[model samples]
Each structure stands twice: as C-alpha cells, then as structure tokens.
Target: MGSTMIEKILARSSGSDSVSAGDIVFARPHRILSHDNSAAILGIFEKLGGKKVWASDRIFIALDHAVPPPDEKKAKNHTMIREFVARQGIRHFYEGGTGICHQVLPEYGHVKPGVVIFGSDSHTTTHGAFGAAGIPIGRTETASVWALGETWLKVPESFRIELSGEAPRGVVAKDIILYIIGKVSADGATYKAVEFHGAGVENMDISGRMTICNMAAEMGAKAGMVPFDKVTEEWLSGAGVKEYDPLYPDDDALYEKKMEIDLAGITPQVARPHKVDNVVPVSELEETVIDVALLGTCTNGRLEDLRQAVEILDGRRIKSGVRLLVYPASRKEMQQADKEGLIGKLLQSGAQIAVPACGPCLGAYGGVLAPGENCISTANRNFKGRMGCREDTGVYLASPATVAASALEGRIVSPYI
Candidate 1:
C-alpha cells in the first residue's frame, strides 16, 4: 500500500493524496526545459495561438546542441530562440558557451528536489539525480506546457535496481552502467521509473549519479532516480539550494521488477557500434583500432570524468595520428579544470579542448569523423550514425579512463592494462 517515489511526486503535483501505476494525472512541472530546438518549439507555441507563456518564470531555454552555429541555419535558429525568449519574458535563458542546458540549470539552482521537471530532451532524466522527476516530452508537448502550465502524465510502473560492492581499479560509473545495460538489453525497463539503490549507487558523487540517470533513457526508462541522501543534500547545498522537498519511496513500495549488480566483477566495458547494449569487456577487444577518442558529454563531461581522464594520461601524449577531443560539460567545469591546470595537462597530452557544449556527440558539428573511421568515446550511446552520420563510421562507448588509455594506445585498451 506504500507508494514509490514517482507515485508520490505525481500525486503531489496532481493535488491528490495517492496515485497508482497506469493512472493518468495532469501535473504542473517546476521547470520547463528546452534547448536549441526552442525555435521549433516557439513556432509550435504560436500555432497553439499563444502570445505569452503561461509561466515565464518556470521556463528555461539554452542554445546547446549545435552550438556556435555550425552553419547559417543553426545561427538563425539561435537568433529566433533569443528573440523568442525576450518576447516571452523568460528569465532563465543561457546562450552558447554557457554549457549544456542540464549542467547550466543545476549550476544555477534550477533543479530542486521532489519537483517534476519536463524537458524537450530525452536526457532530461539527468535532473533525477537531484531527487526530481525528469520526464522527456516532444516539442509540441513543450509548447503546450508553455501555453497551458500543466500536462498529462501516465504514472509508470517502478523497477528497483540494486547495486552492491565497490568497483575495481580503472572501472567507473560508466562501466558499471554499461554492464547493467548489456545484461538487461535495450528495452529492459521500458516506460518504467527505474530507481537505483544499494551501496554502489550511494557511494558515487553527484556527478556519477547524474551520468547514471542521464543514460536511463538508453534503457527506455521513463525516469531513473537515486534516493535523496547526504550526497544529494551536500551537492544541492553547495549549489545554493536552501530548501527542497526530497521524496523517497516507501520501504514497502511495490515494484514491477528488480535487478541486482555487483560492481566488483565489472571492468572497463565498451558498447560496440549500432547499439548501446552490444557490449563486451575491453579485454575481449584489445586490438580494436580507433581514429578518435572523445572525452566528454552531458553524460560524462563533469569534472570527475575529466580528472579521471587526466589521471590516466599522466603527462603522456596520445598516440600520433589519433585525435583526442576533450569537451567539458559546462563553463563551470571548464573553469575549474583550468584553475586546477587539468586543461593544460589535457592540451599537453594532445587533446583538443572544444567549447563547453554538446560537441561531436550528435554529429552536428565539432570533430565529425571521416568515412570508415572509428571513435572511442565517453558518451552514452553508440547507435549507428550517432556521431559520424555514416553507416561505415562507428563509435564505441566507454568510460573516461578507458577512452584516455585507448587514446594513448591508439586502440581499444583497458585502463588497468
């Protein structure tokens, strides 16, 4: 009879005492998130016959995803988004070089615990690390929320994934998650609110938790959440969040499914071309050649990831003829790295530090691969054409340490090796 975290949050937003799986509720979100695609969303808002947003203060826009106007087209789109923000009186707008919207939003305290957040990007689930419900919606749904202030949500069944044991040397949150996704396959938790639990999850810093929840969408999960605890509290407090309502599932809450993963057995994992679940241990593919090694994304571009990569590089330049691209997730992260001299270290290691945005992750701009080339990256997905936009080009998903180690070796090598 107890409620899951999603159920409780939805019920509160719906002004109800309780909600169950399969129940439909109209919930008002604490934040409405959109990125560079806001231009399309703005057009939809106008088609809905909207002049002004229902709640300008609740709307947050960012010019990420194709930042720096890769072309005249993207530049024009950015122009429209800026004009739209000014016209609508939206308060939280971040321009290019400001970092990805997810990182910028949290850096500025836009995410608060126990609140519902709906975004136009699938990785909206990243906010769940802070104890919020982050659900991805389409562009039209975004415009509707802008005009109407509320939207419908079908309460999802819950899945509890329990993690145990400490990760071994050179293994990290990314490898652990890759191993889980490989075990469960792509459609494992479709439409379910996946809650992460146990010591393995609790041991991670806020950055690692964000990476876990950000990639939940890869598993077809509606949302992925880590329980709010001291880690969450400390991070939020540092981010200037003074008050929040953190929600936790009841001890006896019912779940549709459960899974357990022991991190001790996990190692550097790689999700091969065309599928994030097409994973195998790095040891299995030591000779896999790579043309590029990417070291950042919203999924793993935080300071922790950058530090780990720098540690592996350890004053060693990457292999000749291989390109190493290092992208920090946000301006804040970029600045911190500069202060700590990590940026200099990476640059000396033959890494090219790009702007703080979704660079090369979506194949929009930055370092796109040539035909028949392969890249080993610290990104979330490895779907076909995800990075290079060509069937012949391939991408391998791995942790920062693995990517760095492979960059030095010019092949898919384990960091531990």
Candidate 2:
C-alpha cells in the first residue's frame, strides 16, 4: 500500500485499482463546499446556462465570509449567496453565526472517513484531520462540480514529514507547522501530499492536527493529513460515528520524499511581513509595536487553544496600544468556553470577544489593519496587505501563545519567555 493518506482514501472510495504511492486516480467527490466568495462564481455559472445543480445533496453552501455582513460590499456578497442558495434549493446551508467553513463542515458531519471532499476555499484541506482527503478548487472547478459530481485531479507525489520528540514549552502545532514552512520554503511542497507521523504527532489533538493541516496550502501542499488514532477515535465517538476504522500507512509505505522534524528544539517563531516564507524566530524580531492581535480561527479556535491563551493572559491586561480579539471556532465551542469561564478571562485580560465568525482572517471583516499597522495573528496566511491594507501593510503569523504574549507586551514576543 502507498504511504499517502490521499491514495488510501481514493482507493477505497473508487474500489477499482490498488492505488500505489504516486499513482494518480480519477476521483468521485463525496462532498463539495462553497461560501460567499465561491457562490458568486456559481452565479456566473447561471449566466453560462447551467440548468439544475449536478447533485444538490452533495453541495454545501455556507455564509461564513460575510455573515453579519461587515460592510456594504460584504453585505452584497451575502445577499447574492442567499439568493443562490434559495434558488438552488440547496438544503445543506449553514448561516447566521455558523462560524468558519472548516469548523462548521466537520461539526455538521459533512465529512466522512475515506471520502474525498473539495471546497472552494483554500483551507478546505483542513478536513483531512477527519481522515478525509479534502482540497480546495477554483471557482470554475466549483462550478463544474456543481454541474458534474466529478472533477479531474493529478495524483500528487507523496512527502512524509515525520515528527520526533515532543513539542517544547510554549510551542504549539502552529509553531511546528511554521517551522516546517520555514524549512521547506513557501512553495516547496507545492502540489504534493504530506503525511505527518511520529511520537510528536501522536500526542496532538484533533484541533492541533486541524491547525497543521489547514496551513498545508501555505506550504503549497496538495493536502496534509495525520492518520486517525485515539484522539480521532474520541472525537468520532462523541459524534456516534462508529464502525469506522482509520487507515495507517504501512511500515514500508512508499514515499516520494521524507523529512523528519525535531520538535524539542522548536521555540515560538513568527512569519514576518510580506510573505509567509519570511519567517524568523520571535526573539530575532526587534520590539515592533502591533495594532491588533487576533486569535480564533479554524487554525487555533478550538477549546484547548483558548485554554492556552487563557493560561498565559489570565490575569494580565493587554497593552493599551494593542487590540486583542478572540473568536471561537463555533457557537458550540463558544458556549463551552463561556461555561468554563474562558470567555470572561479573555475579556478581563483586555481581549475583545467577537461573535463566532471568520473575523479578520480574510482581511475583509472586523479588526482589519490600517496602513503602517502591524498584526500578530493565529490565522493561516500573512501575505503583504493580506488583511485589508495594501501589499505594503505588515502581518505576522504566530501561535496563539505567541499572539497572546505579544498582545500583552504590545510587540512581538516569544511565548517561551
């Protein structure tokens, strides 16, 4: 058997050939997702004379991007999506405080093990945490899927990133992923499958695994995944998804390439301004003031991530110059945090709690940065001007621990300190 999570899932779903490590297979999609951004593209499909949706049950339309519409432009986008969803009679619609796409899709049980999922958003790969091979497709491809349940794919070469040792203090799966991106460069894993294993990975939870796999696109990977284990078993058990077994790569599983990461030496690092590739150790950056420190994305919005931030800033207040924002990944997570007093602790620490939504991750919603301002975020990308400002605006990507520490200090900070 191949060493690729993608290949294994595809082989089972297709039930035709015994897929090898690097063999490309034509796949039938089990689920397809779209939000406001991609829904607008589907509207164009209407103009192109597409009749009925290929399979309405298979398409999921979410209103995460502009829900509670941040501005007139965003509001218009939401309006377009509402009309489209209603017109298409797409029943699997998530709206009104539904939260981010990645968070909602899995919670709603749209992703099943051994199935192939594709979303219009780049972070669609996040679903791989559930043992599904999910990838992001362009609007054109989304439209095609809307007309036809199948899409073409190239079998990507497989790369194995095996983790060794344990993640050090104040270091998180996010930092580990940033470390990987630093080593591989931003485009190093382009169009490749990444399977993570080792003792370090085994210790991580589903949320942490989701954070790592969600950023696979940042490294230009086709998809990233960790084979389901006890953590996954626990998550699925809660949802009553029984009779499911996770597939692991064989010991001699074929891999096109392999790299081992030592998690013990890792410290808090940040992707500095301009590019996610322009990474530096948090200690290497000078005292740079920040305008915003936002946490809570599909990347780090899970309950444990909030607990870490709460531990770091439980009694301390954020610096006056910095605006610290927190948004839980879902209403369910928010309720749990509130019950556990995490929300109160955050507010007492000078963090502004926003409704369950995407917030500023897309750069179009609440808490965007202005010119000359800097932001420390737990969101996925930090490309120049990615969050609202022109390409010259600065953004830094870091772990929730680092982001929380920096918000208190009003500058970039190494959480280890």
lDDT of 1: 0.91
Clashes of 1: 0
Candidate 1 off by > 4 Å: none
Predictions in order: lDDT: 0.91, 0.82
Q: Of the candidates shown, which would achieve the greatest lDDT relative to the real structure?
A: 1
lDDT of 2 by residue, 373-412 (tens): 8889998888766788774477889999899988998888
Alpha-carbon deviation at 258 in model 1, angstroms: 1.0
Best by TM-score: 1
TM-score of each candidate?
0.99, 0.95
Q: List model 1 lDDT by residue over 1-417, tens digit each.
A: 899999999998889999999999999999999999899999999999998899989999987898788789989999999998888889999999999988988888999888899999999999989989899999999999999999999999999999998889878889988888898889998899999999999999999999889988889999999889999999989899988888899999999998999999998999999899999999996478999999998999999999999999999999999999988999999999899999999999999999999999988888888888999999887877888568599899999999999999999999987
